[model samples]
Target: MGGTGTTGTTRRISRSTTAALAVTGLVTPLTLALGAAPAQAAPACTAGTGPYQKKVEKFLGRPVDGRQSTADCRAIKAFQTKHGITPNAGYAGSVTWGVMDLMTKQKAVGTNPNRDGRCPVNKGRVACVNLTLQLSWIQDGRTLVYGPVPVRTGRNGDETRTGAKKIYWRNIDHYSTLYNVPMPYAQFFDGGQAFHQASVSMWNPPGSRGCVNMTKTAAKKYWSLLRNGDDVHIWGRKPGT
Candidate 1:
């Protein structure tokens, strides 16, 4: 999306074609033998609530405490101004949800500074930012949403944590006894916690030792849209929403 002139492109293609030649920069069609989704244009970006879009919109659409809107960017801006926040360059941000969560709930989440998640969006439409609540929002991966989740992390000191973090995915398996957490599942932006599918307690905050855990539902959603290097931001608490 380009500034105020945000626009996205979509292309459609046909199926059952082999040896197709490239034309007009559209993705080349796969040989029918692969059994991939047919050569079709990328879906249009709408405010619609498909399973994928719904997850994105749910986080983005909730009202700030007493105020919410699906089409009211004005309301969002007003809420931001009231909170004295920079009001974000756009609705896509890393820490927006945490702040918004506080705003609406009028409550703080996470116990330590290491807990808490961020707001992240792809460079343009390349990725999606998804965070689930376990104890703290655990740092997941830079993979497209289908990446592994629910993987275990540091217990006590090993708990997966986010914010001000600086660890890399490559180093994760080095410390784990199981070594099952994939390197790619590590969201390197935050050092401590790496993303994986694991069972962590997350009913009303402060469930994990420090790592982020996802429910079965959230793990599946995270696996669908997240990609490497999508923007992520975490806010300590919400403004007086």
Candidate 2:
């Protein structure tokens, strides 16, 4: 089974009029000809400056004015919408900025995520999970084989256990009896915690139970690159967990 995604409804907006309306916190109602069906007005983008306005502007590659603008609001809203953030009102609040900060760190990992040498490089074909960055990758004796793909680890109390382990079992279509959720391409490592494909957004807040949640593509690749008895080294504490 593949991961699930959400589809959003698109609305037609008159750019010139919408921009003006958004600035004044007014609704931009859709204009229709006679006898035409009425359509819902698009949600007005936020116009007030946020706490992290400057940071958000910098991240979005917009002018660092620290003030909200129509272009900036659209860019931030697009990012929030893509990442499944709620409201997505183009406000540069802590939540939106937090996600952006995580992205910045994830990007910094770059092509050499294991440069810190924290994950065991001596082990042949090891799957390394860095909970701090919420990233996972496959390596064969210091040589990178797969990714530093984004992942969602266990949340707060049910944190994913840290330490070295081995892939003891694998189930292509595993069902979590405890949580009653589908765990596709599951590879068990520590206790009930495993690496599996997640049905929800990886960027969703709070995170998983104890399982290492991955995107469908990442989970499938991990399945192909790893197998039973392969080394699995996990370390670091997940941020906010």
Candidate 3:
């Protein structure tokens, strides 16, 4: 994703085919003839409120209606992109569902820095930005929407403010009036501390000016999942602070 562009590419390939390619170089002519099998069709969207759909709905922070909707597809695509799943065609196919299932299992019992104490009381949707780990996560109540994604916070004297905040404003294409830089998907929580798309590498030097800088793709997802006035908790500490 470009700094100012939120679009993402999708790559689709069968999981079995992917496995076949990995073993192709070692196959003999006889082996190829005897072992090669026809590739199966890719998984399609499971639209009804079955077990899979319910799982997807849970991850998306939506009501687990048995039927799939446009909103569900959008959420699925965002999740696929976030986890590097290819051909992010917004389908809750086998691979997509499998990944989501794993995610749910991994998070079923809670994880570090994301316990009950992190979110605020009565706040339904919470954007938890953990500076110590340089990760961001969005959750609605106890359901995880997105993240633990890499981010670049304010540097040195410009450390991102810590504490509870609300996203009071949003600008899809906000340009920094103070620094004259592009701040795409800007969701301002504090005075000037917003979560925006940035081009900086998370592990490198030179961070932002009190903004939570996420990748354009991530910022787009955040913009979609978060609404104005949602709780935004900036906590923990970045290393070397």
Candidate 4:
């Protein structure tokens, strides 16, 4: 087997664009073409605003006081780490804000699944994964048990499969036979593609080899809520897929 790179979700923002956004206000849409990809470093907390803060809170499914407090940073860091954001520094920086903004926008446009339609009829316990937004939710019948949690799916050459399946097996501490990396709380649904916990980058050049990677916290909650043979429905194409 070959050495696979660590997984992450990074955007290609040019330095010139970053500088220009600082001048014209980061809210303005960029007209300049994006240049080469750079390191997934976060910008300073210079673009704070009520709207941005509100959006962050909304995406996190919680109420933020518009202060970006320590708790808020922790939440943001978790989200970043889950989605493969670099640094995972817990700041609402440009990359973090960008992904949140895009997710909200996608929801508004009806591209992602609605909260109302997250689970199937009469399904007691199920996991719904939206690849487009890299978000997941667990539902028991009509009640949302957990999530809208950030996740990182297979990337490019290793794209995760979408559709219905069941968790046929589980492992609290598992190692990938292919990559030899830790896959905590693994719930195997599709062959070689389980719902597991793994470290992520915001924009790492490498993605998972068909698994749905989530944060340790989210994965633990999933392990607790899900048992073998529970339904798992994965759908939607990732943004730019």
Best by TM-score: 2
TM-score for candidate 1, residues paired by index: 0.29
lDDT of 4: 0.62
TM-score of each: 0.29, 0.77, 0.53, 0.57
Tell me the number of clashing residue pairs for each predicted model.
40, 0, 3, 10
Assess the local accuracy of residue 42 in candidate 2 as a C-alpha lDDT between 0 and 100: 35
- The models' CA-based lDDT, in order, is 0.30, 0.75, 0.63, 0.62
Better of 3 and 4 by TM-score: 4
Candidate 2 lDDT over 1-241, as tens digits, reads: 1221112122232323122211111111111001221232335799989999999999878999998999999888776766667677889998889877887788777778899999987888999999998888888988888877888888889888899999887777676655657777788887778899886666666788888898767777787778899999999999888
What shift in Å separates residue 182 of candidate 1 from its native position after superposition?
10
Residue 68 accuracy (lDDT) in model 3: 72
Worst 10 residues of 1 by lDDT: 1-10
Q: CA shift at 41, candidate 2, in angstroms? A: 12
Ranked candidates (lDDT, high to low) = 2, 3, 4, 1
lDDT tens digits by residue: candidate 4, 1-241? 1112223122232222122111111111111111233335554333334346656766676676676766666666666655566666666666677776655543453323445574574778889887776667776777666655666677676677888899888776666645767777778887778888876532232456778877666677787778999999988766534
lDDT of 3: 0.63
The candidate that wins on lDDT is 2
